[model samples]
Target chain A: MSDHAVSRRAFLRAGGAVLTGTLASTSGVLALIAPSTSWALELEALDAHQGATVLQFTRHVFPHDRLDDAVYALVVKDLDAGAAEDPTTRRMLIDAVRRLDEASGGEWLSRSAAEQFVQVQAMEATPFFVKVHSTAVVSLYDNDMAFAHFGYPGRKGDPGYIHRGFNDLHWLPDPPDGASGPVPETA
Target chain B: MDMYDNRTTFAADDDGVVVVIGSGAGGGTLANELAQKGVDVVLLEAGGLHTTDEFIADEWPSFSQLAWTDTRTTMGDWRVARDFPNLPAWICKAVGGTTVHWAGASLRIEPHEFRARSTYGDLAGATLRDWPLSADDLASYYDTAEKKLNVTRTNGLPGLPANNNFKVMHAGATRLGYETCHTGRMAINSVNKDGRNHCMQRGFCFQGCRYAAKWSTLYTEIPAALQTGRVELRTRVHVARIDHDDNDRVTGVVYFDADGRERRQAARVAAVAGNSIETPRLLLNSESSRFPNGLANGSDQVGRNYMRHTTGTVWGVFDKPVEMYKGTTMAGIVQDEARHDPKRGFVGGYEMETISLGLPFMAAFFNPGGWGRGFTEAMEQYRHMAGMWLVGEDMPQADNRVTLSSEARDAFGLPVANVHYTDHANDVAMREHAYTRGAAIYEAAGATRTYRTPPYPSTHNLGTCRMSERAADGVCNGHGQSHELANLFISDGSQFTTSAAENPTLTIVTLAIRQADYIAERMRARAI
Candidate 1:
């Protein structure tokens, strides 16, 4: 098992009070104090503050040329669910977020993307970093949106790639004649 | 054609049927061949019968649908143990087995590979042995298998067009002054044949071909066997143990149905083709008072001598985008290095085959726990990567074995298989040589950077239940029959005497085709 294989039961028990306290200021208060307000109270696994931290953390881990926050949010959704289920993951994320804030001189969430990127890089070897990075690597690029954004011709169905861009290599120089020629019709 | 679903129950006392325990290349092909010969066969597959339509082109979801994600423990000093301990072998659980997830690299083992012990001489700490039957004995069977699979570049079918990945490899191989670089002889269709569609070059060959262009038994052999009306394929029937009679001959199989109910299907002759891992695990778990050491395991080699090919991947970063994931996962090969050259510091040789993984898989497997600028930069150049996989002949060590784990129990409460492996000195040397050569090939082709990835979870599992001329040497005989029990047979890659450099699927299919004839003859003669 990986080091991130945290005890879900232990985490839920130990952090139950902390999670309730965190939610009290956000969703709990929104429900009691401003139930009829124009703002819809969004119920998420992670608190608004933690969710913001993770979204920023994921983008820094896998910063692309043109990837936006919407793309990185896909990863946050999974992490939020994971933190909800496994208290260890929740605690880890909370602790890591606090440490990042301290490392950024108490301006992690308010700091520039460049400063936040350095903080994430400094803690690359941490379990929180590994868990989030590994999770985001798959969650971020596995969608149809990511494929289109990266210009990857997603899986071929129906007609297949034979008549498509299977052999269309206009970007490359032509090889020797026989290199791309028809295969010999013999054993 | 008669196809029975798991819902259709079979009687526990019906002992007249020939029961095959898997439905991949070995079991599926064997069932079809036996059915063609007017024999009654009941093929039991542990997974559902997922058709081509159910195949998702996406990597992770397809993996969830196709991969055998059973709880199998991994031990020893091998890299896979550290990186992918839960998934030791990347085989499929679906009806077609691993064939559905294969890259379709159809290659015959070289003649010298069949005589590994005699040709390579003695090596320290290696349990090398020559196959009981030579390549000459299997020539006709290979020819038949090639025709059955409709392998490209054979039977008047042209090869697949070279993709950009292949073009990169071709330029590198040419610069290295090595010939024989071409679109490989793949089981994937280059043109329409056998009522299946031609190669679409969909690039997700590992994720199950949606077009049925790849020769998977799910779409090919299993369907053909069903058409014969002499075979019954029951999916989601996981065999737990093989039952033997008083004389220690396998009489039937006891398995769990899809609903987790225990059921027994009696057999006249039971052939175990549940791959190398589960095949030996089933036999070992079948230990009775008569066969105390497990059925046909008197030589103590039933689960010993497990061999996965010496494998790694080398990726080249070019200035221009390669778009490697546009064609078939693997379509080209450089066979120049697949020769017996002891001077290269390793007794056996390897093949450099073109391979491409989608960005999702590449990120997960490129460097398992990698991060930072180096890792992020690689992903940034995902479209500019050209990669090739190195598959070499790894020495089979006695210590590198598969045993029943007393600690980890599977979903069925049965003890899961514990795969333990340590790289032999020969394997280490071979990998080092291949890495250097691979990096040089990329450099010669103007690659700015080349990254050598460590070995991932094995797909080419072989040589757990090997064939030997003498009963004392191995678990099975030349015809894949258990040496101790006449009615029991070992199918799949487990019957390989030595792990050859070539992909084992082609040979496994050929052996199954040949074994069907031998089994039919024995049944006729009443040899047992």
Candidate 2:
């Protein structure tokens, strides 16, 4: 298939295979496991539960109805790698998960989506929340799966859209040809 | 048959060479113009070279790669200070300077803007001044700059085709009884001209146009200057200080090379074009016993009167998919509001130009520190949103200045610039008027909901080192020569007397072309 014809499902399926490949490259440093059928994670420093909470937190920060959980897991991958590189990041992630559980009556994962959102909102001003949100805001949305889900045409225009659908916005009324006024004799 | 020369080097002790710092619209054009006249020059640029082929397509990665990521601190009541405290300006650090990141909206300053102090009279707390020269003095040079840059809608070049974003802006502008709206006078090519490729609607103007369609000095004037074999272009050379002789005439520059070794290059003249912030910081850092206050800073106006245009963004969410990011980043403009009508509850004027940010930048700048359902829902309409940037003339204030930071230091161990700014009352009123009018344009175009975002980091960045008729009033004369030091010149937007309601690249190049002619004439007359 042409590169443009690759659908969102195909993109996510390719992402899963890439994750399996990453598990081998990070053999000593990382451990891979499938907690659910929809998505799998290979985490370095963050544990399974810590990685899952970060994924959930990223979803609340940028909740797209059409994006898959695997797309949101990209944020977890980045956060996990950062945590592995720095002990401060690891401590912040661990402390943030603790605060969430305490806020949600010591059973944050067991609570409803509404209850989890309230806990996330209460910690919006925290440094950990700011760090995760800032990282995820760029990480999650910049990947191919999120771009496909959001209908953002990726940066594929080399020769560009001059001969393609550049002027194909037929929804709005056609403006007058002479709407561009006279060219002033500047030179 | 040689169209270019990529290799040219100058000796460090070459005293006869004219040294021009920072290769943007000003210094790049000035260097080339002098080289074309057979004058030897050495152009020193702080950033490394990245040609069109090295340009990136992605937003976040490209911004990280191209943006001036040096240390800077901002303090003010302006929202940008709270939103982006460390990054006060969004200029490029690459060899072409901010010209690589510019939107190609080339416009000449309106005639009335040249005499702002006389036109607007005394505003209560503003210290505005008239330019030493008039519009007539720069008209022929503007004509030369427009042709050299191949600005569309002039010199018989056709304007770029209107995109969906422009159509949205046009529909709203027409419905509001406003005239003078169209695809703008862009420096981007509409057809193949001057051996460069035409724009292909690539939709990534800010990431450095890979096709060389947009006019950046990196691909144009710098190479042309080298082709003459009269210029030596050195990248990764950061100038630390401008050294002067006993007579207080600038004689050479002290700089650190790529290896971080201290070196000095002797020069017959020194022209500074490191944008507004760094230009003033360089002058202030070069304090000596002879000129203890700073070189050419006898009037204490070197770091004063900074101006970034009053700017904001208004995004409109429509029911249908607009696909706003399909064409050029900024292709459309509305000029009806760009007039000095005091009845609009403010002095000066503003221009509304169609702008698009990629999904990554949109999320980061949409609300800055916003989250929750309201933020996500607005972002959900990414494919259905149309956006426009409102840029009005901001007042030049003495206190809105760039000073050397007391605590922060750069890699070279120099104090970084601390940019302090607050909106003048007139600036506040102008932004409010522009924001309301900008939102109304989108609303008239059938937007279901509209989002008004505060200004991001400044892209305009002007008027720190200003020009005036009298030596006591400003730093430079009409010719951009320093009043106290004849051989020193301010060759960038930093010399702007007033921040006119126009994009500055065209005017910056025009002034450089004029400054080149003046410098060449002075050399011939045996005058420094």
Candidate 3:
């Protein structure tokens, strides 16, 4: 997608390395070094299709927040595992996305990347879906040093959170600037 | 988020004579009080501050940085995260806590709200009843809290420039013969108080007030408490458990440091102010062989009786512009219907209020119904868009509780708060009634378009660790102390006995001040 920064493969590589502690500060939101083997297995599980689906889904659910590699690593790990531990939450998120795609007359997983990105947030009212989207949404747009870890918002060294500092980078999308999608009908 | 790095252990080398957990209304005011009383205090906050600068212009960014938590992921039941299937509820995790984005309307609990059981004792699937304390007990405190927060009544302000939405709401209430008054007791500075400026009528309270008009802990109590130098605020330390000795005495707290380092601090006593979900989770996580059922959990009631403000909303479009978002967070409240209306078949009551909504999210979400151009048209008539809420009462159900998840953990290896709440029958009825009433009000006000948002989980979570005289009957006591552990206390909305039809910041502050006084007395006796 024109808006995306790194390719899915590059993200996978960087995230995988960071998860395994081989790399450090990938995107610099969170310096969380997830277990190495766990991340390796996660990358293998997503392959390419899953990654693409996530990007598209994220575009709609969190057009405002950033979805860099770190967030991908975190969220992907949860999805690959099917959210068994958090069944209710898992079902809610899945259903929300499913509903969003259905509202668009297409399947989120199967639609064109651009198409999926537009309607992924249609079902945001679903509780579990809201939580999932919130995780990525805040990470995407919130600018701060400590927020880099898991792409959270708020500045680091705030003396308030677990992480101290981050890149203080902002990942907002350019405004309509004239080249944009059609405005929807009023509900 | 982890146990080892928990900041709840506010005992540093400078362990103040007192320590307050959380920097929200309750903790902030209590800390200030203790400091004023010449007691050293440490105010420990789980969330950090969002500077006035970071409060730029977008709703989402402001919400993430200054609102609650960035991560939507919650702690699961036990050490597992069973992210609830389809129930999304929001709770802030910053220094200001939920106050940062709160719609600052404060209301005193009705006398009847104190004893729901006495008035509404027959509700099914609940321990619905009156509060152990009374409104009268909190009356003086409410007045004191109001003054400290610089609350202003909104009955009659200058040309508020009523949009179609306001007219609709006013006409509807008049037609219904309800005692609909302008929302009152806002924490906004109608005039300068101390050094903070007044409300600029920006309709952006939840986005982190830029001019410091709203009464968030950051702008109010926390700053005052910090002024004493007797108070030290340590943010980002995520506490996991309350460390105790063999006799069941709490020594201090254990938490993971911000750098992910595990650490422990010693204290004479501990207070659980981490809100409904986190407070009980902390009590449960502080398990030891001596306190097997969990710290102060010998009664097994540490995490029970969760309640959310029974809430519903009515959105409508008026022919004229109602700059709803151009004032204080909440301008007024309707308390006539705020009692346990059993004839209506519900366990709780409802509070009605006028709220703000900018064009972006509110207009888009409640744009009369569908997607695309339809949504756009709704925006074109932004002035016509208006929203009102019926904050109903939710009964407490054991099944609806907050517990630690077993299967999942946050980045830090700690259990998450697993909340299990389903709307009760009464709650359902109340929501329906509120929607109907809201619709009628909009119609009376001549709204061209109208709609209702029903029974969603509100951010104002309360009543997880209810207070009772007996440990067997409740998690904490009248003073908000653990039933089993005399030295342990609670200082947040978690100790709410009943969900009143009002914002809880004031109630929580009053209760916390009472607890602080009790703590001071006990400290003098060395019982702490």
Candidate 4:
């Protein structure tokens, strides 16, 4: 497939899955888990239960309507490796997950979205929360896959952005006469 | 086009050549100017030469590729130290230095700004001094530098087209009855000239302009100097210290090559331009029995009065999708507030320039440790954000300086430079005023919400080994030649006597062009 075509397909899938996930929890969980299963199974740092908690935690930190489990999984993979190397990071992640469950009365995953959000909020300023939030912010948003979801056409190179949407602003009124004009093509 | 003489071999005893350390705006421009005057120069740059083809357009990746990222320590009450401890200055560790990563805002120092001491008067807790050289002394040189860099809005080149972020800024400025809003006078080209392409508006000005539209010394001065056949650019040669003779005259530079092997390049005259941090550190490290306090540091002011511009960003969320990241990173500016008005609770002034950060950087810097719903909402409204950066004159404080950290050691086992900064009362007041005015402008343009961000890692590092008329006041003289050592010169912003309310690159290049003329004249006269 062409590069644009592949990006379009990913865009469509990301839109459908994330929108469905937002509307209903059961369907949302299924939609999130389907494409992310292979990556989830490859977790080296966290066990299945801990990985699931981390996945949920990342979504809360960034929490976009269009973001999918795959974007969050990028954060999970990095965190997993970090935890594997550092004993402090490993202990923080495991303990944070346990605390969330205890706070939610063992309904951390099945609880209402509002309740789970509150549990995450209570863990704010904690080392575990800060670690997860900081890592996920970069890993989740810094990916090309996530860029597609947000409608960010990453990096226009080669035949640059000049003749493209760079100057196209339909929302803005036309600039005052002589303030700006179309760039003359150079020979 | 033999535009490179990558000298792999230079004898240690070659003292006839002039050695310039740090090939950025200052050193690069100076090297080219001196070479054109038939002077042989050995330009030693600590970083690798990454050409335009190696530049990526992404934020994080480009930062990794371009940022200094050396093992430096930060010990200041400033937010940058707390948020970004390791990366103190956002300069480049490449051939062109920070010019490779700058946003191409080229501005001249205002007439009054050259004499901050006379204009602002003696303020408490500030070390303000009038530049020994005035704006008039540098005006002709600024013109020359502008022509060399192809700075737009001059020499008949048109200003850049206004992008969405600029449009938003214009709309707001017009609504607020502020008149001086326009696409800025940038060094980035509006038309192809001097064997370089016009800007393609790739919106990655900070990530190394691949189009070569934005003038960087890496592509412009460095190549031009080499083509003269009088310049040799030695990249990845980190200068450790400036060596001087018993007479306290600079004789050579001791450096580490790409293989971590110690090498010495003898020089008749040595010019240091390794930014503010490293420049002072080098002088301090080069202490000898003759000048124990550091060479040419008789004033004991080698690393004093460090100043980064008082900077912050305010992002305005509008009802419409501004799509701020579609054009040049910072093309538009509102200069209405740049006038010095002490009645507004600040001693100095600031410029409100339209700025845009990519999604990844915006998330990291919007609030350093920010998370939760508010942060998420800002990220979700990324498409609807219009941002403006406030670049203003910050006070020069003796206590806020770059000092050699006794604890931290760099890769070469040398004491790493520790930057310590505290926002002066003047700086704090100026920032508050700028924030208020910035938010008001966006609000006038119908912004639904606005968020203020603290200062990020500074790209504009200035004033550590500043120029002074008196030897006891600063390190260098008006001509950038060291006060105590005639053959030693400072060719970077480190020689700035006072931080002005303008971007420092143009002034740095202007000073370098002027310094080269003086160096050539002095060589003929045998003044040293």
| Model 1: share of real contacts kept | 0.44
Clash count in backbone of candidate 3 = 87
- Candidate 2 lDDT at B323 equals 83
Per residue, candidate 3 scores C-alpha lDDT tens digits across A1-187 of: 2323235334444543123213343433243433331233244224344444554564444332322444444454555334433445445555655565567676567767566645544444556445555454333333332233222222221221112111111121221211111111210
What are the per-residue Cα lDDT tens digits for candidate 1 across B44-110? 9999988888888878888899999999999999978988888899999999999999999999999
Per-residue lDDT tens digits for candidate 2, residues B261-348, read 9989999989999999999999999999977877889999988999999999999999988888887888689999999999888889
Report clashes for each candidate as comma-separated counts.
0, 0, 87, 0
Identify the superior model by lDDT, candidate 1 or candidate 2: 2
By lDDT, the best candidate is 2
How do the residues A24-124 of candidate 1 rate in per-residue lDDT, one tens digit apiece? 23333233333332332132446667777887788777776465455566787778767767668878988888888888788598998787877887888
Over the stretch A60-168, how does candidate 2's per-residue lDDT look in tens digits? 8878655667777888888876776666887999889888888877768778999899888888889899988888878877976666656676676545666666666
**lDDT of candidate 1 at residue A177, scale 0 to 100:** 47
**Shift in Å, residue B37, candidate 2:** 1.2
The lDDT, on a scale of 0 to 1, for candidate 2 is 0.86
Candidate 2 ranges with C-alpha deviation above 4 Å: A1-38, A180-187, B1-7
Q: List TM-score per model, in order.
A: 0.90, 0.93, 0.71, 0.93
In candidate 4, stretches whose alpha carbon ends up further than 4 angstroms from where it belongs are: A1-41, A102-107, A110-119, B5-9
Candidate 1, superposed: residue stretches over 4 Å from native? A1-43, A102-107, A110-126, A156-159, A170-187, B1-10
Give per-residue CA lDDT, model 4, range B169-240, as digits (tens). Answer: 888888889888888889988888889998887888889998899999999999888887788899888899
DockQ of each: 0.30, 0.29, 0.03, 0.37
Clashes in predicted model 2? 0
